[model samples]
Structure formats: C-alpha cells, structure tokens
Target: MRATVDFAPLFRSSVGFDRMLNALDLASRIPTVDNWPPYDIVKTGEDDYRIDMAVAGLAENDLTITQERNTLVVTGRKAQEPQSAAEYLHRGIAGREFERRFDLAEHMKVTDAHFENGLLSITLKREIPEAMKPRRIAITSSTTRAEEAVPQIEARKEAA
Candidate 1:
C-alpha cells in the first residue's frame, strides 16, 4: 500500500516554495529507471557529508562531476574505442553511460573528491556566511547612561 500526496491545495496558497515542492515531488518519485552504478550517502560529521559511488571499471577521464548552484551532476561516459576481436561468452559489467543528479542544500560546498579502490568519494561541507549566521545582540539596561542627542538649531526667517 502506498500513500499519495497531493500538492494541489498547497500550490494554491503557498508562494516562493516551488523549489521545495518540486524537490518533494522528485523525492516521492524516486523509483525511476536506470539505477546503474550504485551510490551511498553518509553523514560523517555535524556539517559534513560524503557520497561514495561504486564506479568500477571506469577511468578518471570517463567521469565528470560538476557543481552548479545547489545541484550536483555526476556523469559517466565511456571512451569510444574499436570493438575487441575477442569473443566473450558472458558479459556482466555495465558499460552504458549514465548521468545522476543530486540536489544539495544551501551553503553546501564540495570539499574534495578522490577515486580509490573502484570507489569515488565526494566530500561536502556546509559553510554558512557570517551575515547569514545567527548572532547575539547585547542588551542594555534602561538605567545605563546614554549618549547626548544633538540639538537642531532653528532657521532664521528671511525678509520677503
């Protein structure tokens, strides 16, 4: 049994939340085709995350990782080559090209990426700007001395 969410009602009233709604919709429909090249996402620290992908048999030149705004795009394209003369009785490895996209939250930055032991690891860290971070404001008591206000001088009347 599966439950369906209808955003029609919310769409009529909510404003400036289309992106979030779209993400929710996308997440709800996660069972899509082409799930090749498995991947994993792990939270290593409070503000750190890592995405590891099992990209076996793929060379560094055949993969592309790009960060565009709040979206991360990972594409794998095998290099074109002449067909091997050797005949294979069975083929198990997947050589088809694929593209995967991941949506990241605000302030998320890709710190490092490395390929080792047939696994591609991508590290991410959230860097909040000072202006956007929460700050504490000092409170002053009413009895505290205040600076004197500058008095405004009256303008002289000109003779008509």
Candidate 2:
C-alpha cells in the first residue's frame, strides 16, 4: 500500500520552491520502478558528494553520464553478446541496460566519474558562484554622520 502526499498546501503558500516540490512528487511516484543496479549516495565533505553504483558487468564505455540543469542522468548499455558466447547454467549478474536520474540541489555539479572493481563512482560538488554566496553589508548610522557634520560646520562658522 502506497501512501499519497498532497502538496496543495505547500504550493499555495510557497513561492520559488516549485523545483523542490516537483522533486518530492517525483520521489513519491518512484515505487513502481525497477530497483536494479543498486546505488549509494554519500556525503564525502561539507560540499562534496559521491554516488557509488554497483554495475557488476558494465565497463567504462558502457556508461554515460549527463547533466541537464539540476538533473544528473546516468545510463548504462551493455555491449551485444557474440553469437558464439557460451550459455550459462545460472546467470545472476545483471547486464541489462538501465537509466538512473538524480535530482541535484542548486549549484550541484558532476565533477568526475570513474569505474573500478565493478563499481561506478560519480563525484559531485556544490559550487556556489561568488555572486550567489552570502555577503555582509556594512551598516552605518545616518544620525551619527549628521551630528558630526553639524559640529564641524558650527566650529567653522564660529572661527569665521
């Protein structure tokens, strides 16, 4: 039994959160999909992340990673088997093609990807642009500036 979530209240009260809400909706609808090629997402650092996928029989050339806006897509297609291949009595490792998508947060980007020991590792870094980072603004009191200027002006007038 799948529980449905209604985001009507969130949609009505929030602005500029459409992407987050859409991601939530997408996650809620993921129960029907195949869970082949299991993966793990880990936070390596404060702003760095890694996704390790268990692609047992896939080679480096069999995988393709793409980034479109805030979405990261990882696809794998196994090479065609030769006609003279030996038949296996019991086949367990999955060589089937799969496409996995990850919805990244703002500023998240794929830095690198490599395969080793039957595992595909994808590195991600959240690189917030300098313009988008939080900055401190110096606050000055107008009243203090006015008072200092008035005293200076009065002193100049008395001298004159």
Candidate 3:
C-alpha cells in the first residue's frame, strides 16, 4: 500500500546530492521507524538552527550528543534502578534507551547545548569557509592597443 517515488529526474540536475536523495528514499520506505521521545527541528535564523527534544525523565548525564562529519547522534541511556516495592500501575512516560540520528548539511557546526525543564536544546550554525565563499574577479580595461598586450620574443644569436 506504499507508493514509490522516482528521483531519476532530480539525479540528472543535482550534483553531490545523492546521499540526501537516497536518505529520503529510504525514509519513505520505512514508515514505521521508531519515533520515541519526540523531537522538533526549528530554524531560528538564516544560518542558525535548533533541535529541541522532549525527554521527560532523562537527565543531562543520561544523554549524550555527538556531531560527526555530517551526522548528529543523540543517545539516551537510563540508569537501571533497584527493585522497589512500588510498581507502576499505568506507565506513560518512556524511560527506555534510545538512539536518534540526524543528517547535517555541509559546513554546519554545533555551537551549544542546553538541558532545561526536561527538554534538550541543541544549537547549530552554518559557517562557510573563506576559500569556499564566492569572490568577485577584477576586470581592468586599459587604453593600450592589442599590440602592446602581446610579448615579443627576441631571436638568439650564435656565439663564436
């Protein structure tokens, strides 16, 4: 009951975007993927972004955030507790271990992270390198004729 999406047309026009397109294709195929511990991605500014995840029972020590070359991983591991006489009659909040991954674009860097009121906020900024930025080329027009622009080569004389 799933409809497949064709990305052949996009592949012809885009370069270096195969990974992103493939990821989208895979995501479409797997519709029942784990969605525990809901999270939201928000764009605050033109080059600034934030990911806020609601982890009700997890503490700062229970979670780990890692930023690799082009991926961000968020993992939560709940500490095992000793057996208590009090048993949960109706358990609602999720306290299980979970790992979530996010694909990041090039030049994206993680700047800060904050844990407040059962929510983890991760801030990211896009910083393009100086070499990668576009620059204007200088075009100079001189009054000199085309003859002066060419360099003349002199013939070498044979020595006795």
> lDDT for each of the candidates?
0.88, 0.90, 0.91
Residue 36, candidate 3: Cα error in Å is 1.1
Cα-based TM-score, every candidate: 0.80, 0.85, 0.82
Runs of candidate 3 exceeding 4 Å displacement: 142-160
lDDT of 2 at 89: 95
Query: Which candidate has the top score in TM-score?
Result: 2
User: Which whole-number lDDT from 0 to 100 does residue 27 have in model 1?
Assistant: 76
lDDT of 1 by residue, 43-137 (tens): 99999999999988787788999999999999999899679899989978776688989899989999999998778899999999999999999
lDDT of 3 by residue, 1-160 (tens): 9898988899899999999899888888888679988999999999999999999988889999999899999999998878999989998888889999998999999999999999999999999999999999976557455536678798999998
Cα misplacement distance, residue 160 of candidate 2 (Å):
24
lDDT of 2 by residue, 3-25 (tens): 99999899999999998898898
Name the candidate, 2 or 3, with the larger TM-score value.
2
Candidates, ranked, lDDT: 3, 2, 1
